[model samples]
Target: MAGVLTGVVGALLTLLLHGAQHVVFGAGGHSFAQEVRLASPPRRLIGMTVAGAVIGLGWWQLRVRMRVIRVRDALGDPPVRLPLRSTTLDAIAQIIAVGAGASLGREGAPRQVAAAVAEVLCARLGLDDRHRRLLLGAAAGAGLAAVYNAPVAGVLFAAEVVLGTLDYIAVCAAALMSCIAVVVAWPVVGRDAVYHLGAHATAPNVWVWVVLAGPVCTVAGIGFNRLMEAARRGGPSRAIHLLPLRITAAMAAVGLVAMTLPGVTGNGKSVLEALVGRGGLPAGVLFALLVAKPLLTAACLRGGLTGGLITPSMATGGALGALVALGLGHDQGGLSMVVCAMVGAAAMLATTQHAPIMAGAFMLEVSQAPPTLWLPVALSVAGAWATPRLATGLKQL
Candidate 1:
């Protein structure tokens, strides 16, 4: 029953986000908000600046009035409870941010909302702390599963990342909840795989190149994390939170970037999808986007906009992978290029999130890649994850 309810809510949330995007951005179902061109340059600028103000205001409210309870804070031994008001506000704020073309993902919002709902239910049922945490993790994973239509990856993510343990009961519950969520969401969101790699077959000869791409992805992923941490540092410092001035400056910066490079505006999903379909973009544009996206994403994160980094990370990784493939003289539509993309994307996601298993599983599920490519993907993910620590001796990632 809990699974069903969570699943239904997750589905509804996905639909609501899509509907919001359609109305706001006229994306018409592009998860990445591709249709920024649909709106005039002036309009995009106005919309994004307004969104920044709204996001800033919302964050200010939560920081001031509500005792914000993060899932990470609550995941520890002493389970912390979530406040419904704060969670709902956060979720709604995320919706508005993403709908207005903020460079972030909606995935985290659904998970947070679902986990908050689960926390409330568990409290009402008088569940023990351990059970509460487990249920919360499961519900959160269900939301992710529903969003991507990947139940197994959802279960693994909850077990591996959320709960930080592989308890059998928790795993089973997460699995069941993920299945329920995806099943419920299937009708509305449809059952198509997220990325369609056409006529792919693994090329063992080029597997070495895929392995080499691992280090590239690792550097990119680690670079992004470091930038984000730096940005996040300013969040609590009063000097950085200079009311409208700071927010206005940040939004204006984003507006300037949007006016010049609209591709960097949203989560970069459409951009990634375009690259996937077209194989490789012109080298200049590809490199330019690669450089521009992370900086913009860092700014957004630092500027008080709330959304997930998963999609953005994936987009960046995909672009990097395509660029690498192009450099290697491989056709974009070749199996080797696809493998590079998968490995690159998985590598970045795993290293950044510290969940190689979840990243690999998610890449596999979302791309629906042939099983033959799994070994290369796994190797690339493992190498990418380890390279950062080796290079910087940074165990924090």
Candidate 2:
């Protein structure tokens, strides 16, 4: 039952996002939210600010009626009954924000919606806390799988990260639900690789460069988290807890930044796709985006807009990798760049989410890289995971 509901909602969210993009940007096909852009800065600024304000207002109202519980909260904590009405509202708000180019990912909305469905069903079925929690994790992961078309990664994310431990039953349930969700979603959203990077060969020449990219991705991931924390801390005080003011200010800042560095806006999926298709970008441009995207993302999220950072992080990590490849003068046909992209994205995602296995699976699945590259990518993720632990320990001493 949870699997069916998750699949249905996931498919609907996919269609809704694509439809919104079509209407807003006059785009012909399924387009990433970031690709739906206005031609002029002034228009984009207005669109972003108003969209942020509306999202803020909607969330403020929803909070008054019922506190929205995050998927992470249900993963490790007591099973709190999720209210359907508030959950729906939160999903709608996220859709609107991303559809309007608010610099956020659309995946989070569907995950929350799926969790709500599971919660409602589990509560009525009189399931115990453990069962309810597991189902919620499974549904959330299934939703992610539906969106990204990554069933294995989704199962791992649920079983390994969300549940924190995996048993035979847990693994079976997660994998089953994720596969079902993807199957249901495939008709509405064609099974397309998120980023089609032709084909990747193991770049022996770039192996050292990929290794070097591991630490760079680690630093960037840590810095991204810190910026987000700082902005989160800085926001409420500045706005006196006023949601509209907070969102407006933060989104306005994003808009102004977008005026010059337009690449910094949106989830960065389309931008990443373009980079892959075109092989590589200028190192200077990649560097600027690498630095600015985290700051902009922090601003939007910290200012009270609800969205996921995973896609944005992936995009930024890919760009960072391309930049490194540029320095190595190995950016040909984007093969080397794509290799670096996989490594950096895996490292950053593993560090940020604390799910190295999921990170490796996701990067490989989405990039469609040759199996030979997976070991290097996994090793890079391990380094990324270890770096922070060592730093924190040294700091504690």
Candidate 3:
């Protein structure tokens, strides 16, 4: 009962923080995207290069002079925490990256931010063992909810991925926090849904396509998961001696490539939006993007990457699936043919995250794409199955 109470409180906090983030992103996204577009290609490239350099330089100097633990490392040890300065800075930098087109998600920022804030509270409150971790989880959930404006999704993610289980107090606190965050963010972000889906086609449900899509998604999901692991940073676990140079160099490379395929850069929301509306891409262009996005993201985190895998991978998978469908020659997927490519994208994303509900919800929000997409559903399921198996096999190998 006590745990349940705390959980509810945590949930509310999660909701509140997530809501706050959504407002921030919504108010700023359009202008930010436009700014990127206005900048000369060279200028955009330079901006990316310079930002990466600064980030890298900071890393190096900080590590050499004092211990600098990124939020990613902070999370490695359970019951771990980071200073608010580091956490907030990461949130700001990452959002700027996404705002400026970094092909990553803004959602991760709140998680780190919330975690650090919760730790501060825990220390001041002198929370006990269970309470301390619970606070962290609740804070994370709150942050996610604030960004997504979906308390349930945040709750599930925190319980499933972060805390690894549900508890009474956590559920309560999270619920409360989620509510608070949303309430606070309402004015700034507005009550509009993230991605508006206009009108959806109910379904003459294509079983044949649905069945095939599942397997295809499975393959895609497995491929993506492997890519992430392969891209995992290679270096000492603790702070490296020369962190800045490494990150700056990686950023420079990513910037050069991103100029060619902006789709491959940033949190990928804009690209996905453009694709959904335009209903197709030059296969060659998309193919290049799919390859570049993952590889660049891989490079970005080589040793000290701080962000979430779910969003970037989802966008990349979608692009790959879309490209595949494009090759199949399906145009808008009109009433009959439907947009097979977009279907593939959504299905592939669903598979990789193993969060079909979240994937479905997110895609629905982001693309305003058709619903009751049976084929896409099947594919996402297939990908989820394959991703774990592949990961397991890779581990064995």
Candidate that would win on TM-score: 2
Alpha-carbon local distance difference test for all models:
0.74, 0.75, 0.58
lDDT of 3 by residue, 1-397 (tens): 2223223333443344333323323333343444445555676577666766665565555445544345445545655568777656656555554544455666777777677777777788887767777767766766666665556656656665567666877777766765566555455444555544322332334444444565666676677777776766463244576556666666667667756665665666545554554444666777787777777777766745456666677667656656655554454423323344445555666676666555555555434344455445545555555556777899999
The list of candidate 1 runs beyond 4 A from truth reads: 27-33, 77-79, 201-205, 236-252, 331-335, 385-397
Model 1 lDDT at residue 119: 82
| TM-score to native of every candidate shown | 0.89, 0.90, 0.77
Clashing pairs in 1: none
Best by lDDT: 2
Tens-digit lDDT string for candidate 1 (292-384): 888877777676665788878887887787677777777755656666667777888887788888999998887776777688788988887
The residue pairs found clashing in candidate 2 are none
Candidate 2: stretches off by over 4 Å: 28-30, 199-202, 234-241, 388-397
How would you encode candidate 2's per-residue C-alpha lDDT over 25-124 as one tens digit per residue? 4464445434444346775576667767776777777766667777786665684567777887889888777766667778888889988888889878
- Which of the two, 1 or 3, has more TM-score? 1
Instruction: Rank candidates, TM-score, best first.
Output: 2, 1, 3
Q: lDDT at 5 for candidate 2?
A: 78
Q: What lDDT would candidate 1 get against the real structure?
A: 0.74
